[model samples]
Target: MVAPKYSRVVLKLSGEALAGSLGYGIDPDVVNTIARQIKEVAESGVELAIVVGGGNIWRGVAGSAKGMDRATADYMGMLATVMNSLALHDALQKHDVDTRTMTAIEMREVAEPYIRRRAIRHMEKGRVVILAGGTGNPYFSTDTTAALRAAEIEAQVILMAKRVDGVYDCDPLTNPQAKKFKVLSYIEMISRGLGVMDSTAASLCMDNKIPLIVFDLNQEGNIKRATLGEKIGTYIGGELNGEGDH
Candidate 1:
């Protein structure tokens, strides 16, 4: 069996990925499939930290903010992440994979509050750690949260699991001519405004020298493939000079 290139990694999953083909809300089958993939990686002895988005349940920034403040909307978004985290936690447990859900906010009823030492300990013990609540603050996206967690946990790579197979020059769904990039540099991503992640998240990874691999999670075995270092998507690191140049 192929082993992962890194001993520890952080996987960033969007809420929609858990929704499957329904395109909305939580889907048990999809969550179970993802959980099984995660279990595969965990069983391979890789310490995994997952940061999930809540866009399927809510996007605070995109909600009907007719009378609501931006901060309020963002807080709601954070709550949505907590919900997703709980769901993922349950799914992982159902697969017999030891897991813990830690939130940035104080939600003792649902999960433990985010403590850097505790989170590290969980991973050290081979328990998957699910990070939720989006930094426990407003004005930050889950992308930034994943970057922050990766840096804090000293993870070697960030697995950005998305719906698209990889990063494209344009929206692949709409642009038939959009080209997929195999590799990209932090400087290039920022300069080109690729939106692989928020600027803050990209800058954090750049400064920390952590690599980010963006790939589609909808495909089966992709999580394990990524863990084993298979070339499947756009890789952003400090070494890229151009497309497919990693």
Candidate 2:
């Protein structure tokens, strides 16, 4: 077996990725598939931690834009993330994979509270850790949470799984001629306004010198491919590579 590129990694999944074709709720099939892939990664001797979003259930920014209190709306979004985390935990448990869900908001009945040492201990014990709730605060996106957790846990890279194959200069769905970038620097990503992640998250990753791989989650085994360093998606925060940056 080929050795994986990174011993520890942070897998960032958006809430919409769990929605599948339904586009509103957790799709069991999608969750199961993700669980299976995650199991594969864990079995490969890679320590994996995940940070999930809550857009499928509710988007705090959207709610705030519609007249809800920004903090209240964001808290609701955090709760939605917990729901997604529990659903994922159930699926992984069904697969017989040892998994733990840690929340930032301290819901002891449902899951463990977010503790930096405890989370690292779980990963060290070969258990997958799912980090739910966006930093236990309003105005911080899960993307930022992923960056924060990765830095805390000393992860080598962040696997940013998305619906699209890779980051492009424009909306690929609408523009056939839009160019896909194979690799990008953090400053370039920020200057280009790629929208792959919010500025705060990108800046955090940049400051920490952590690399990110943005790839399509819909494709089976892509996650594992990322772990093995197979060159699947746009690599951000690295030396300049001269391919696919049209």
Candidate 3:
């Protein structure tokens, strides 16, 4: 068997990815597929944690634009993340993967409150930890939460699973001639406004010296491929120019 490349990783899942084709709610089929892939990684002895977004259920920025208080809207978005986290936890459990859902918000009934050491301990004990609630604060995106949690847990890399295969200079869906980046540095991404993730997230990873891999979540075995350090998507780290002019 091929040994895993990174022993620990943080997976950042957007809510839309979970939504699948339905586009506005949790799709069980997609969640199940994701869970199966995650189970494979967990069984391979890689410590895994996940940070899920809530745009599929409620986007705070959208709500705020529609006249809701920004903070209140953001709080609702956080709750939506908690809901996604719970759904993922259930799917993982069904696959027999030891999983724990921890929230930044104090919701003792459903999950444990987020604690740094406790989260690390859970991973050490081979539990897949699902982090939810987006830093328990408004104005922060789940991307930022992933970076912060990865820093706290000392994860070697962040796996940013998206619907698209990799980061491109232009939207691949809209531009058929878009160039897909094989690799990118955080500074390059930020300077070019790549938008693979929010600037806050990119900046956090840059400051912490954490690498991120943006890959297609819809692809089967991608999670495993990423963990094994295979060249399956656009890798972002260090001081390198965008290498996608091919």
Candidate 4:
């Protein structure tokens, strides 16, 4: 098998993806499948860092606020991410892959706090780092967390594993006429408001010149295909090629 083109990459997995078809909470079988895909890519000699969202457990901004404060709601959302990270860590371990869960919040009982140098060192030693707790602050989405972690760890690409196959001009589910973009530039995505990711996260990747690959993780081996430089989805970056951005 050919090695992945990028030496290091960060994977952004939504909590809903972990839920599989049922679409509610963490499904062990689904998580194990994802872990296996990640393991396969890791075996290809690519360093991996994962940033998982908390939407399956909680969406602070979307949920009814009631008496909950905005900051508190966001903190609850961050905790939800920690739960997802721990689940992923366990699943990776089941695949015999070394993994570590680091949180932005200091939760020593469950995992280590986020430390940039330590995260880089873990990746250097071939351990997949699962980053949780959303930048240790409120008002930042996990998408932003992925971008921040990718920049901090010097990852070459951000593999955004979504339910959809790739970036569409409109929500493909609702708009039958929506067109799928094979390739996109950061400026194009921003100007068009394509919703590939939040503007903040997209701008960060653009500034750092980190390519983003939006692909459907539901397809078996898609993650591995992505790491191996296969043209499987929408590629957003400064350059365009059949194998995706280099």
After superposition, the stretches of candidate 3 with alpha carbons farther than 4 Å from their true spots are: 241-246
User: Residues 55-174, candidate 4, lDDT per residue (tens digit)?
Assistant: 999988875367677788899999999999999999999889999999999999999999999999998899998999989998888999999899998998999999999999999999
- After the best TM-score superposition of candidate 3, give how far the Cα of residue 155 lies from its true spot, in angstroms: 0.4
Task: Determine the C-alpha RMSD for candidate 2 after optimal superposition of all C-alphas.
Answer: 2.0
Query: Which stretches of model 4 miss by more than 4 angstroms?
Result: 64-67, 239-246
Residue-wise C-alpha lDDT for candidate 3, range 20-116, written one tens digit per residue: 9999999999999999999999999999999999999999999999999999999999999999999999999999999999999999999999999
Task: Show where candidate 1 strays beyond 4 Å.
Answer: 64-67, 241-246
Give the range of the ten consecutive residues with the poorest summed lDDT in model 1: 237-246
Superposed model 2: Cα runs more than 4 Å off: 241-246
Whichever of 1 and 4 has more lDDT, that candidate is 1
By lDDT, highest first, what's the ranking?
A: 2, 3, 1, 4
Clashes of 1: 0
3 versus 4: better TM-score goes to: 3
- Candidate 4 lDDT: 0.90
